[model samples]
Target: MDTTVSVSAEPEKKPPTLFERLLINRNYAFMWVGMATSRLGNVVFDTALLLWVATTLARNAPWSAFAVGALIFIPQIVALLMGTFAGVLVDRWDKRRTLLWMDGARIFIVLALIPASGLFHLPFPSGSDIATFFQMGCAFFILILLGCCDPFVNPALLILLYDIVPEDDLPRAFGRGQVLNNLGTIVGPPLAAGIFFTLGIQWCIFFNAASFLVSFLNFMLIRPERNAQKEEVKAEQGAKEEKKAGFVHELVEGLRFVGGNGVLIAVGVSLSLIALGAGGLNTLNLFFATDNLHATPDIYVYLDVLYGIGAIIGALTVGPWVQKKLGVMSGFCIPGIVTGLLLFTYARLDNVYAGFIVLFFVGVSQATFYVSFGPLLLKVTPRKLIGRANAVIGQLSTFAGMISIGLASVLVTSPLHNKHLTLPGFTLGPIDTIFMVVGLLALTSGIQAMATFNDYKLVDKQEETPAEKSSENEDVSQPLISYVGRPGWLSTKKRQAAICLVGFLVCLLIILPVAFIAPSSTAATVTMSYGHPATGETIEGMECASTVATRQQLRTHLTLYVNGHMAALPTGIGIVSPKQPGVRALASNGNLYCLYPLHVFEADNIIHADLPDTRTYTLGQFFSVWGQPLSRTQIADYKADAGKQLKFVVFDGKGNEINYTGDPGALSLEEHKTIVVLYNSPDVHPTPFTDWNGL
Candidate 1:
């Protein structure tokens, strides 16, 4: 028997998943996990800190909120000041050790703040403007200390990455690092919001402190073995020789390397301008969230959440395409333009939901610009000069940001602080004015970036058509007509990227307005007849739920009527009121009053809202808008102290009365319908509407 020997085809190899690919390297995987843990802490700390400043502390002095924001950025300014020197120092040190020590130091520093915050409040009179400023000062000092760690930590981390990963894997390693960072960003805000609203600011800070410890532990576990130690020694020896070359000499060498590079100069200038605009916008976002959008702490968290998601999308999907399709410089220009337009749109939008969409797109554009710019900077610079080039860019951007924030603080607080300004050409609020200026700056930066792209310098021009394909051949070296050529169609990679970029933006444009844009004229009528023992006076009008007054003012009024009952837990929801401390805390000073989009108890005695759609809204939502609780046992403190249970009777437009107890807050309202919230005895029932003429 003749036996034919056959070899089976090799089993197909499956591509590694993102996590698998990232974690394949033992060191990077540990660092990434640590980074994620650290990010969660940062998010929680930031949210709690901001809420503490914006709501808990700076409730009276709104400007102090800006001060809190400005103080947080103070560390970035410090980085700009010391970044070059710090880079030089970082190169001399063992990066892994440096990272470990820095993380350990930060954990202790953050932990110390919990006690420090309380201690700082001791000397200052509580609930006073002075106390607010004192609190802000404490925050500023803490942030400066935190900021000081970044320059050391950031460069060390970068160096460690180079030391651990092979040259071929650097890009993948950095990409993984960024993905984890964004992942932290996306999850942190909402988590912080949940904890802040429930467990309070202390828990948030504690969590953040713990995160740093986790990161430190992960760094401790990174073992690069003998090769890493050797590289570190080599680096230190090189650094020592470079030191003998003199600091000025080394600085000049790096600067000279960048001097001839046109792309670096263009990117630096463009980014500086963009940073200035961004700084102004960033300064205003918190205020805009509370003041303009009338958002509570929970809603403000969405801004960070949505932006993080958009950034992730941009980084993973859209950014690569945009960067490839548009040359790096041109790509920067596109995001700048789009960002400017989106900011303008954001300034105009009145709805919080719409604002979320605008912020999301803005985030996408920013992410694209950042990812594209970094690679280009790295690609063009000599390895030796890279640190200095980055430092220069960082300093310039920081300087611009500082100037813009200072200017914005002044403009928004005093000089241009007005609800509306009737200038010769335009009319807008002080916030809107800042937004307009920033938008224009971004646009200008985009134009400047676009102008910097040249075929001979950075971008490769498409080869000239062969003589056979040309209409006619010019005589050898005749002076060609100098015509500026537009960039040719992008490569297939870029085209695909562009499609993804446009897809997100287009989807945002179509979906948001359709879902949230309400008819300006379609008003809803809300009538509230609430009083103990049948006072019979109906409190109606837009004032009850109108979000016209400042949040502080609305909250003050909300506290007066809703009182302690607002924070009480729903009885029928399988829990008792005051059982969970978190629920109890949420009821008090949680910005719950801001939930009311319209003032239901205005002098008009009828809450009028231009709703997006005609869907029936629950009475609970109405109570939420009124800054009151609606549950089985309570309705805005009505007879709650008297130990009386709450009840409700609802009449539809057709005079069909529906009586319900144990949380009738879910009851729906209709045109010309009547809802009576009764406490204790039900002797005085609500009369049904016989005529619909009064609606």
Candidate 2:
């Protein structure tokens, strides 16, 4: 055959859709489907929880708005506490295992809401604020657990994406993943609202639980491709890096740097104001839907669907153009100002369908702002302090959100709940005033951001060593946008690779305990199965049995540390008045007020197990009797604040101690075995007390 050369333009290959890409790789397909399924469940669960508490449980209560607002803020508080440590945790653990466990935990958490919902339906405190408070506490319990699980899931997913997908296709993979996530949010609302209305909140919860189980199965099928030796080398490198800089130290440096710099501080403050207004809108939106908009709860949930749809449109449409044409500062700030104005308009709107259009734009503005925010931060922040700067801003914004929600809750619950203030064009009630005030704040932040960063430019100083670099790293002149679009996308975990340019921005933008009558530091109460003032009433299946046995019964040692200081184990715990510590004139229904199965004879830490049988009691039983609240995040008056954790250790008779990771309230009070409860002291490995010293 003679050689014949035929030159023709090569046909261009079309890019594969998300489904087509999935068909090529089994592992990545599993991961993609798993994430989508779980995300859908999560959105539905969140919707159900919010509506159930706000509408069904606390329907007409004074602080119904506050309780509704707390649903969002409380989780932010938890993130502030543990989010920093998540990166380190993810680096250390098996990514797949972590994913599976997180899904499993959330499934259990969603199911628990069923019993939690029944707390409101209880006849004893029906239709009362007390019952609502109790239900809120129960709901908080689940939220806290889910919140703790969330931080680990996100980072782990990012790493797993790197592992299972081809490096070149990572960006498209993540972008498509986001599309699915937004889709889930779009569907989740109406689905949750439908299930919530037709079948009840229980069905909504069960549906979420089933979705998680489905996600779990898909993840289980995923066999990640890993090079064993390479992983070992990677682990060693990670450990070495961990030793270089601690989060606290870096965060302090970042705070100092940010505090001194005008632009950085404005950036931090502006981000906070944005979070505040967004949260405020959400917190009051339910009430706005029913009261001003004159819509039902079913109609109210659809607003989220609209918001999600608008987000997709904004991200695809105005998001890139804003950065390209308006510059980073203007891009981030302009949306803030627009959103502020929209919030004011929303405050005055009466038609349900019209309000929907307004909410859709609000989502659009927020998404546009978020699109530029990550780049703006990268441009302004030094390469080294990137993580630290982000952390500080995240913390500040979270606090702002928490404060806005809290303040709104207080204002609405006061005499202003029903009071209305009419302006020239519109009327202002609690919801209206809140929307206006938050709107003004957002507007102020946007204006300040524009003023401060209007002429800001990126500087190239990556070559300078940390010791040589100045605090204000604005020496070399360059366009801010020029700094990010470069090839060095595979930077650190915070900066993320090109794969995460959009996903990172989308992800970055986005628990409380109980109170009791006891003299805890705080006033939040824990939820109980049943409320009883009688001596022998059982709580959590542990009977308030007699502790009056003359002979020495089982005595378990108890110790408590609140904020690193040892709090005195209060006197007369589980006792009806004072029996031996002081004189008691107790006669209840022809019988003396008996001691609970777990009771204290003195103000000491020894918890006497005076049960007639050998049945062991839980620390929770003693807490219920003592009128104190106990949970992983809370103990009596003490709470685990930001960057702190609640932890405990259980000791056996052999002087062996194991750190207990489960519920603090569920700790068993074995004879002579000391148990220590420590809040906000993760570093101080507390040991159980050995010397009972004769009770």
Candidate 3:
């Protein structure tokens, strides 16, 4: 007889909800709090910056808005170019330390913007040409330095998030982070606007600096050692490759892994294309609100608040709901199409409130997409190759953004600014056209995603258990597998290297135009005024000085040429022509002078070549460079046939004057001298500009 007892099977435990997990997880809680606080500061800083540029500085000069955008995006352009290499470094460094130091560095860098404000002439002098340009340039440099910190900071954060969060709880971890980020978005703008209106942009910047410190301290408190076992596993795996792969080879290995994965490539590529459309929105949304919707600053703030609210709700509800209903792939595809429609509708709405409503839903769609996409990214990418996979996606998206911003710059600044396009049956403005194009692209991406869904249906198939997948290299001959486990371009390390080299060149091509073609301002300046010395109606304001400085510092003389006559005093085209183009170039648009601060071109008021030590310029070369006409019979529009003779004169700072009695072109530009040309108005003897020392 057998005395056998039947044992009951233990019930399976259900996973905790996102909120429940956050409540119990200490490290995740710290990261969430730190990110939320810092994000609040970022939103406030961005709002303050936009208000300062739009309402305060570029309100009247809308084109100057492009300059403001260039300042912000130029750094992003640089960061994208270097992001891949930076990711390689992150894979080898202590992620926690890297994040902490970067935040610390940001605090000091942000504080510097205050002092820079003094140099850039903040509170924006109404008529100072050099002040606004110089300020924009200063803002650019500050943001550029800030941007350098991101490539390191972001990748480290990505790595750390994976390091600390349990795989099953990751969806909740990311969702909670998104909710907090959106919370910052909701509260930050209004707070920034309040601070900007009450204290100033400086205080808003100060708030951001302080927030960085908060994040830094929180980062210090986080105990990443809870994930020590996982880290050990990674270390052991890394040790295996130590004997075979060098840095480049290791990077190539990651590339080969990603290249062999079809789902990652498809997601990365589609997102990149969609990002191009999103660029126009980022670059032009503020302008659209202010210019097209006729919205006030308060309305703009309100619209953003609405968007934030919707985003928070969506992050909490929509993401999970979509995944449950449509599965991962289908959920991702549906949102893109809906988001496109919402965005397109937003562009066409004339009523601000209607726009506010539409943009809220747009935010919902975006948050949902992000939530779903984040998990998909983590699911498919291998632990060892996660950094490079993310780097590849980031680089592609950034490259798209760079292209879009460049295109936006061209469209916004050219005839497209306010010009309307007459299509076959309807008329659309340039901005509207941009919206339509972006909308169609997003919609097309969604349709393509639907068609591609079947290709990845088996991605979630459990043919292999998690352990089996983890032991993916058991087949050493094909350590990394393609969709069909077939060898392709990434079959060899050499092929992977070739792909990486080509990718690097592509990045270079994308960044070149942003660096070279975008309008970059300088801090060096020159005070300028134009008009008759009698009434003395001068163009008040310092001009943006040229970025190019003199090879060897030297002062120069000026001698104006006209018709064929000489006068007794100096005045005309350039009142403050420095010996160097460094400061001068700042004030020139091509060869034409800008009514600085104003950005208006004064074609007649231009400086030609640098002052010569001994060689003289024919008054004709001046006209050629100035895009004007100078001849024996006519000086400018003034004609010699009308009983009028051109007069040219030279003067020293001390009022000592010499009447030139030769061809106007023959006069010498001696050092420390002033030249003037009186065209047909010989009776009007202009006073020499004696403020050379002040310049």
Candidate 4:
């Protein structure tokens, strides 16, 4: 075997201007447009679905927040496996057709959502309290399926772009692609919100499906000549001999290639770490809005818009400019540093306005990173190997995301003895921890980029044909091993079971505390009386009590009073009580009276007596021995039941009443006690109730 690298002759022609260049290259433009359109549709659909799940469908579920994470992570996990097979198929078959099929499949899958929405109208399965579960479940399943297919779609498109674009134009092509991608970021969220508001979430899915169909049609229009030539050459050469291999082998080959190429390896690892940090921060943004910023649901759109505007700026300005002026590594590094600093500063910001400013910069940095890296990766990879290379890089990045998720999950939810002290002033929720982690990773990636600036020079110039072919084999070597090893942690069975168990336990733990501490204290009262208007006769009785009892206790206590006979009266005569109480005491001359406390748990108790006769009962009827004279207002309202007496008992921490009935659900025992002390305490209020009933 010849080991020496061979060089291809350099072309002797000047490159066209960027605009002219893109217009002349139909393949690059088509792929760029298709990818951008597809991505926009995806974001719109995903944002809509997420909003629906969070606000309408799974809104009440304990695991609602986890649904979003599952949507992101499940697809990534599937992508790792499917992406490898997709790479193999793209290499072995027509790349354009592979992409076409992927897009077509996505269109159909999203269209299926139209019927799935019908499930929402179905009578919920009997015994289920949360009816939206089945509908949301269907959505989740569809999203997972989409995730499975996405790996093939992304890599195939990238490889196709590499196949059609000349080496020198690759960076600008990718930069333009990044601009289009950022344009998607700009359009997606607001479009989704608008569609969701006006047309409902189902229509967003339909629109996304339509976008996929359009992208598929565009893919079909692209010429397949270059892909066909590459496949024909490979077919003539026959299958390259391999030392026995599996998925792990292919995966490792990709890993090894990335590892061997210092520039590629640094880029991959740095970006992975950066993703770990940035993804965690993004994950916590919603929580930050609600918890820290005190934002309601409606405000999220404005927040998203702020971030989107920054992303647009980065994509349109920083992204293309950096790709042209600085090498990709420097472009990535600059943004990485800026984003890190901004994120770190965000941690210090207590005001929501400040957070918005920081997040905007964060969005810009993220856009810069994406645009800069895409072209850099394409520059190092051969056209034929781009699919596998991306698969491997994607797998690593996904793995990094998974790790970040796990870490953030632990940091956010884990109970710490000194949680308040762990991060001073800021209530360190899961999001706070995630932001800190992401910031550190970004700083590390930025520093690493600065350290490895020299290595990127090797990627500036294209190699000769023989040497390029050799590098392709080298690039593929590590990925082969990564593909076969099937990283132990990525096992679907283990991950699913573990996630379910942990989620279940977390739900149980969170619910238990709420169940223990969430009942409201109630205070209610009722009154009844018996008297004759023509004769000066009256009979009135009153009792006051309070209990920290359950609802059953309150019901039973009221029932007993309502059922008991007073002055030989029938049980249903004229008992007046709250809904929890029942009826028994007699009524006469349009007057009603019954025994009840003015306060139930924590309320003021008032007592009054009056006869139905043309005469008003004096306070002496109830508290005749009291020395203080009753106020005229109090005298007019007082009423007495014939041959009945009134007595007052303090329940202390229990509901109590005087002359007036308490408002239902008025106050807790603590509040009543505070009010009572404030009103009656000699030190605070010199005027006290002269007589409990007369006051």
Scanning candidate 1 in windows of ten residues, the lowest lDDT window is: 567-576
Instruction: Name the lDDT value of residue 89 in candidate 2.
Output: 91
lDDT agreement with native, every candidate: 0.59, 0.67, 0.60, 0.53
lDDT of 4 by residue, 1-695 (tens): 13332222234455676665664477666766677778889989987886676555533233444555655666667776686577677777678888888898888888877765642445432112233566677787888789878867766777777678765777777667655766676678878878875567778988898888878877877884556667776565465434336667766766666656555666776678776765555555655554445444445556677787888888778788887898676887788778777876776554667777888888888888887877777776655557567767776777888766655544444332113222234334334434554666676666665555542353333434667656634444322111122445444334433433453354345333323332211111223222311111222332211111111111001110111221111122222322222222222223322322111110122222111222322223322111112231221123224332222112321233323234212322221121121111123211111111000
Model 2: residues >4 Å from true position, as ranges? 1-24, 118-134, 227-236, 239-248, 260-262, 459-695
**What's the lDDT for residue 645 in model 1?**
51
Q: What ranking of all candidate models by lDDT puts the best one first?
A: 2, 3, 1, 4
Give per-residue CA lDDT, model 3, range 275-336, as digits (tens): 87777777776666654454555556878888888888777788789998877777777778
Q: Which candidate tops lDDT?
A: 2
Judging by TM-score, tell me the better candidate of 3 and 4: 3
The parts of candidate 1 lying over 4 Å away from their true place are 1-20, 116-125, 228-244, 256-260, 379-383, 422-427, 454-456, 459-695
The reply for model 3, stretches above 4 Å from the true place, is 1-29, 81-96, 118-126, 158-171, 223-231, 243-265, 375-387, 422-427, 454-456, 472-695
Please give me the total number of clashing residue pairs in predicted model 4: 65
Tens-digit per-residue lDDT, 1-695, candidate 2: 13332222223555676666654477888888888888888888888888787656654445667778788887888877778698789988999999999888888888887876662345322323344567778888888988898899989999888887877778668777767877997998899877775566778878888988998999899988788865886788788676665756756777787775556766786787777666777787787776566566677888888888888888878888888997777888798788878877877776878888998998788789887878778876666677777878887888877877876676666534445443467544556666666666677667666655543455554655766554444442222222233334342222322222442233222101111111222111222222223355665565543324322246676766665665666444554432332222121224444555565543346676655565667888777776677898887666677777777788864357876799978888775577887677555555544223211
